[model samples]
Target: MTTMAATRRMGRQSWRIFSMQARRCSVAHDHTSSSDPKLTNFGYREVPENEKSKLVGNVFTNVARSYDLMNDLMSMGLHRLWKDRLVSKLHPFPGMQHLDVAGGTGDVAFRVLHAIHKAEHRAVGKLGGKSEAKNETRVHVCDINPNMLEVGKQRAHKLGLENVEDLVWMEGDAEALSLEDNSMDGYTIAFGIRNVTHIDRALKEAHRVLRRGGRFLCLELSHVSIPGFQQVYDAYSFAVIPAMGELVSGDRASYQYLVESIRKFPSQEKFAAMIADAGFQEVQYENLVGGVVAIHSGLKL
Candidate 1:
């Protein structure tokens, strides 16, 4: 699949809020830049609004090779469990069309495909639905980073899914999807929504692309709620995670940015509200690991 980027000029109000968040994140990260009338946040640092996506792309590029490794190390292998939970919630089946946006690593797509295979295998014996089992299922793995897309393709190949015609790698922007409206049965963005420059716009695109009764699910790092555990989590996020990134990926700044971006994201309730504002129904979120990660789900009703 071809990759397409979404770039648009920011409105006055949105730009103003983004600018202030950039400055606040800068102060927190201790990376000060000159005051500019036009700016956006690049992991706690303010840069030209137009340059933010490029800077973010560079960060992901630098760590693309080590992204999964760092995820395991930083989360102590919990990322996999979190992702598995997300896939379980998706409940993919034969003939389903899923769009795994921002899942450049193909984890979500892989799990869903495997689940479909498992489900079809079981139903084939009892129902003799061999033809149904052979349906052309598709999972479009879309991301903004080409490097990440390459990694995901390599992973799919490694998994012996090279013969599968269903997995398609696409480089796309979440804010403005290249896909047709109401074309997909399900939309998933795991650990990807927080990276979007405009989370609400991304949600709107998700709404647009999903057919009626389709599901929209997003898994992301969120604020920790446990009283004492919050402090412990913060220390680990600020200190240990970045150090691990430096040692493993040789890029502490990128991991530092990761931590700060999580900090800057809206809380569970607030984010759910944004999803509702984007015109979803029955918007709700499940807090995982004491809200260190959250899974928000809605239906395009």
Candidate 2:
């Protein structure tokens, strides 16, 4: 046989081997050895779909007390500004019925509630008299982790809002919200959807719970694609975040998983497409911190 022919044959064999290995890895990563379809990602590893939530719950339970502190240290307190930007995009108003899922710490919920009150007060003052009807606004804070919810409740008490009639806390799963159809005027989830086992199901649930013309907004850590900045951002994420998590929360493994989870999540465009597929319209997103985080928005219209 000619040397060139032998080279061609060798190339074909190498390609076949590569393809076979890639397929095997893909199947194993998405399913068990028995080819079970009920497997999902837990960070970089694959696990039973039913177990992901419990694993995630334990992680949060371990760090619930220091979650906020870790956020401050890791992001240099920019999380607050990112959340405030989310609320401003929400355009909250009086009499709004908002559901803040995966927001057990009440960060987003508190901002929505405060925005509603400020808007209500401004309208009341403009009318030159107090309205007879009280503001019927409600902000429901929901999370899958009870420990995180307890942290939010304590914060509310510290702020003297424990007795506030408009605030409600519920422990609920994002993929299967207990809310009625057409129930909420707005839905927001900050840094939460990435932790869900089925992000598409959670998006559909967000659409289901929202009334017509309602909006869905999500704030999450996302991929970076800038020229030189991407490398710097990645280095910080992999090295500094876990260290900060250990120093502040004493849970290095959980923070390491969190960083890997962000990498495993879909890109901003792909996630926006998923939201649109979930029956949301007018889908859009804004990248913050050069794509360290992204805020995706959609309307139920």
Minimal lDDT window, size 10, model 2: 7-16
- Per-residue error for 264 in candidate 1, Å, reads 0.3
Candidate 2 lDDT, tens digit per residue, 1-72?
474343222211001123433443444234433466687778778788899999999999999999898887
Clash statistics: count for each candidate: 0, 0
Which digits, one per residue and each the tens of the lDDT, describe model 1 over residues 31-60? 224344356566666677668688789889
Best by TM-score: 2
lDDT of 2 at 220: 92
lDDT for model 2: 0.83
Residue 30 of candidate 1: its Cα lDDT? 32
